[model samples]
Target: MLGPLQVRGKDGPLRVPPGRQEVILAALLLEANRVVGTNYLVDLIWEDNPPETARTQVQICVSRLRKLLAGADSTVSISTRPPGYVLHVDTGDVDSLLFTGLVAMARRQRDEGETEKAVALLKSAVALWQGDSLTGLVSGPLANKAHQLDEERLSAVELRMQLELELGRHDRLVGELQLLTHENPLRERLRGQLMCALYWSGRQAEALEAFRTGRRILDQELG
Candidate 1:
């Protein structure tokens, strides 16, 4: 579930029934293969104060989600345990998990000085993101989780560009780096990489300008 909440069967894209059921399914998917306690599920759905019927409503949501999954012929199954529910799904089926694994592999390749391989791996990892993670479901505790995943994605992109720069592809990276720095002005690593790219491309004046812009942004934002 990288972008919007999606469940696909062997045939095609499976339609996730809307409303609270969607939220319940998302919460379960986030912690697939583990039991998410009933209380935690309640908090995820209703936040601080849930109504007297919150537990019942949660059960209803889970039942509906199970039906939807079964109807879609999905291999995943939700098991009712003592405390709550567990969504049984393969790790490979989740885009976020695949992305994380790819990033980890890329990091290892980068450490081994395999710049080309690392760049390719990172490119594939970043491509898994269709849009903002958990879109339309970013509320409650999931907001922070989404933000963390987004930061990871940005780091992967920065690392990929850094590898490209190391391979003397600085000239080709200038435009992309410029846009990245503009989008994440306060990210020192990206700014530093941008400066290096600009300098290597013989754009010395622009490199100095980039540093100045970063320093000014840091002072304005942090001071």
Candidate 2:
């Protein structure tokens, strides 16, 4: 699940049901093709303060989601098994799984001495993320999962930038690295890449300035 929980129909994105229903749908989709226990769903949506009828509510939500998906002529479906539910969708339909798969393939390409192919694969992987992972959702575990996904995205970007630098694209990477560093000021690897891009482009003063700025930010943030 990237950005908002968007489910597309044949025409476009199907209108997702809002609030806790959306939360339930998201949780199921996150564990797509696998059984997610009703208990786990309740705990996730309510988190230490579930109502007495939480399980029933979860069942109801799932029923509504099944209807929504079916009515839209969507391929996605929810199945009821003992003690849990399963969202039966293709592996490629889930963005997070596809992202990791691409990243794994990209690593293989890098190992095979095909850096350009690796970078292209990574570009596609990162493109799957529309914005912050799981933006505007509640549930602490899902938020933590989102943070983990965001970190994965950053690592992929870091690897891609490293490969680009090795390919002698320093001059072209300067502006893009500047923007990335600005967006992620606390990321020292990105800061280091920005510095390298600047120095290799004959902007030594700016390179040093970038270091100084990063140092200040790290000290303030870490301390």
Candidate 3:
């Protein structure tokens, strides 16, 4: 559920029903195991101007999703509870959850002075991202959630590169860091890391220039 509204079963990928149904499933999966309230889901599906039949539409969407899951032979289940529903699936089954666990493990490894292991784990974690979270389905609450997840992904990348720099792999990291800083000019952490990588790579002038560029951007945009 990280990249798209994909629901894989024992056989293969299950075709998710279109429109509000997909939104409902995404909302449930995002809060998997926790019962999401009916009102909350209604807001997610229609933003602010839901129709009078919005609650009934939500119920119908849930019902369709359940049948789709059953048809696909998915281990995942949606159970109705007071106020709303809960998506029952293993945490590991969700890509974002798995990525988060890997990132946590990587951080632990890095804290333990195991730079190589940390780098490897972070690489695996970052690779799970096929694209932006919930791509092509941005609406309402999920859009904000997706943006938050993307920030986490960028942070993880920055952490991984920081570990690489600590290993004196500055020469190899300079190119990547430069591009990342260019893509996210306002990201102070990435800019700082890029400056460090350039300095350690024996490009002192380039490092100073990077700092100047970042400072200018910060002053211009933030002030």
Clashes of each: 0, 0, 0
Candidate 3, residues 112-175, lDDT tens digits: the string is 9999999999999989988888887847588899999999999999999989988999999998
Best by lDDT: 2
Minimal lDDT window, size 10, model 3: 131-140
**How high is each candidate's TM-score?**
0.93, 0.97, 0.92
Relative to the true structure, candidate 3 has a C-alpha RMSD (angstroms) of 1.7
lDDT of each: 0.88, 0.91, 0.90
By TM-score, the best candidate is 2
- Clash pairs, candidate 3, are none
Taking every candidate in turn, the Cα RMSD to the unseen true structure, in Å, is 1.6, 1.0, 1.7
C-alpha positional error of residue 169 in candidate 3 after TM-score superposition, expressed in Å: 0.6
The worst-scoring run of ten residues by lDDT in candidate 1 lies at: 137-146
**Cα deviation of 55 in candidate 2 (Å)?**
0.3
Regions of model 3 farther than 4 Å from truth: none
Better of 2 and 3 by TM-score: 2
Candidate 1 lDDT: 0.88
Model 3 Cα shift for residue 60 (angstroms): 0.7
